[model samples]
Target: MRGIYVFSDLSLHERLQKALAELNLQQPTEVQQQAIPKALDGRDLLISAETGSGKTAAYLLPSLHRFLATDAPKSGTRGLVLLPTRELARQVFKQFKQLSAFTHLQAGLITGGDDFKYQRSIFRKNPELIIATPGRMLEHIKRNSCDLSDLEVLVLDEADRMLDLGFAEDVLAIAENCRAERQTLLLSATLKTKGLMQVVDRVLRDPEELILSGARDQHGNICQQIVLADDRTHKERLLYRLLEKEQYNKVIVFTNTKAQAERLGGAIRYRRHRAGVLQGDMTQDERNKVMDWMRRGNINILVATDVAARGLDISGVDLVINFDMARSGDEHVHRVGRTGRAGESGLAVSLISASEWNLMASIERYLRLQFERRVVPGLEGKYKGPAKLKSSGKAAGIGKRTKGRGDKRRGESEAGAKKPKQRLRDQKSIGKRRKPSGNKPAGDQAGSGALGDGLAPFTKRR
Candidate 1:
């Protein structure tokens, strides 16, 4: 009976069943059916599933069952769910509280953009569930507040996004404080990186792995399109033209940086469109208010960065506009995945400039779907010259501007981009040495005849 997944045969408490029925949840989703059983059985899990695949319920249902099934004599904090952004933490907290409305369970969200005093008071209640972001949670930990030793389940929702936001170290630090035998569940939209794999290895013990395919590449209901923009100005014009089509309602416009997000939001607002900016630099209160406005339909357009936009479960968003090319192909997927949520029909439009051509190609290749590339009626021109792609992780040929160390002003340094190598005591103690070069090594002629590796040459290794 252990580790077996059977939603049909599974029994839930009458109260929970009633709550589910009230919410119109008649049947378990494919992911829920498969994941809930193992989670309920107190097994660590690593799930690579798609966005909007009902992952929240998959983990929440089992967590609820565990809470209600076991006695909670003292609930200082029974479950800890770490998400990458404040929006996701709020969303998860809301969902869990919704399901636990008729039960004795209590849940709290610990995130930035809120009052710490209020959060402390909420945490003092010893909630059955605590949903948080790693950065804010770590702050709480450092203050000698919020005990996690009593945590029974530790869920890292959107695990890949957490790493992208540079929360890996904070996540590990917090996780180390949690009980060693606790049921740890890692849920991600994708997990191909070695860092993510290493995290899974460290956190999960004999985990039951589940890879729900098909959800990754095919969001059947969403129609994706790529539009060609001659330049930044042309892209803006095309965006305005698209918004003029009344059919596109509740649209979200994504940008790669905070400055662009603010500018776009300002332009839209100036045009009498209900628009707002959502970025990490905004205070928690400001971000919350903006999200509330969007949810309340007071704002028609949300211009945001990846940090602000990811993990948002806002309903009725019918259009997603990528103003700038996404840095990674996976990020492209996450951006489009926002609109086509909860089984809704949606449209995703990408504006690709000549420089972003390579990024566009990579996205198409990843999805295995070639979009029809077309230009707006008024905007048509050939690229004047080949624009050098930036040398960062961003694919070359996506833009004409290359931001390199050479581009920096006289006083500025490229320190932020250059990460120092992390030294590990164990690896050093192992005394492993890289094989020395037998000779002067292969020349450019022997390789590809031109600095030959496909990737840009890095600074010479010390």
Candidate 2:
């Protein structure tokens, strides 16, 4: 409770302070400290902060405060939250419920994979706060089951992810229906993408831009490492050995594809470890069951794809294993962010094969740090890879094609040598060419040149 006074100093409602106290949340996170005040002032916001930075609470508290302080009736969903995934929507809904426990504000969740009838029934009541995914929310809007005319605040959570999932049009359509003067907030891990900016221009109005520490700066508590493997088999062996050796409370192994998640989950279970699989293709119930098992310690290992695991707020994750290298640096940051949350010490290990070395290097360059390379005893990889590294620390041979001084000089020499030969051939060809005869008509000559006979130009002799 040492820093509990800091939140009160922000002029938050007493009820919210009580709720925060009950949750044992003392100090406001950096994102909360900066975002909450401006959001409370009813200003449009565009925030770029790291994952696991309490961004949910940053926007939730202010919106809840505004609702609780107002004397207006619970009209058509005063507060609306749009997320990229159902899991994230569920997570945000849970948090909203917890924070608004002492208030009269009712928050309803609208996402896919649930009973449509049940969701429609909830929408009929028109809860003051609504958390939903873009696709399902758009569907409800189209069916006339949802209303946004009275919405006072609209929050787009994980805005970049929404654009990445191709929900930009749906989100924009939903925004278009909201009150023109409604307060809009766009929160994301990165704001550099063009798609996000397009949505921002469409929705937010003169928003106050807040840029906080990014993912690279938030890796203080995570120990990152990379292990080279010869191939998939070697990677599996390495992963199996790590699971057997490392003492972790909970671990999430990330793969690039759903099939890989299933295969890895099965392999981990075969080794007698409690493991579960999560992917985008799974129904909401199935995904919830897997997440519940992991939370309750029934599953110590969860194999997941990036889409299924994004914005998931699970606690007690001590290790994150990249069973397959992430396709992008941002995805790598998000996968490893599952661990090292809430100031807990964690480990992130990447199993890199020779083919993925360049990818691993790019991730390192993106993070601006080199991961410690580890080798397991008696299981060393045969593919040592290139011994040299480029100045950027990437694998030496994988650099972009750049001409060196010698290469430039040789190219110039080759161009000069070929020019004289080309000119000589051109001159000889010019000497051998027959000139057009001035005696023939222009059209006839043109026709004779193509058809080898001037008579082909006309049907009869002219």
Best by lDDT: 2
TM-score of each: 0.79, 0.84
Q: TM-score of predicted model 2?
A: 0.84
For each candidate, how many residue pairs have backbone atoms clashing (under 3 Å)? 5, 0
Error of 2 at 4 (Å): 9.0
lDDT of 1 by residue, 23-127 (tens): 888767677878887887889999988788889988988888888888877756889999998888888988987788789988888888778999898878888
Give the Å shift of residue 213 in candidate 2.
Answer: 1.2
Summing lDDT over every window of 10 consecutive residues in candidate 1, give the lowest-scoring window: 384-393
lDDT of each: 0.81, 0.87
Q: Tens-digit lDDT track for model 2 on 302-377? A: 9999975579988999999998999888788888889888777899999988889888888888888889989888
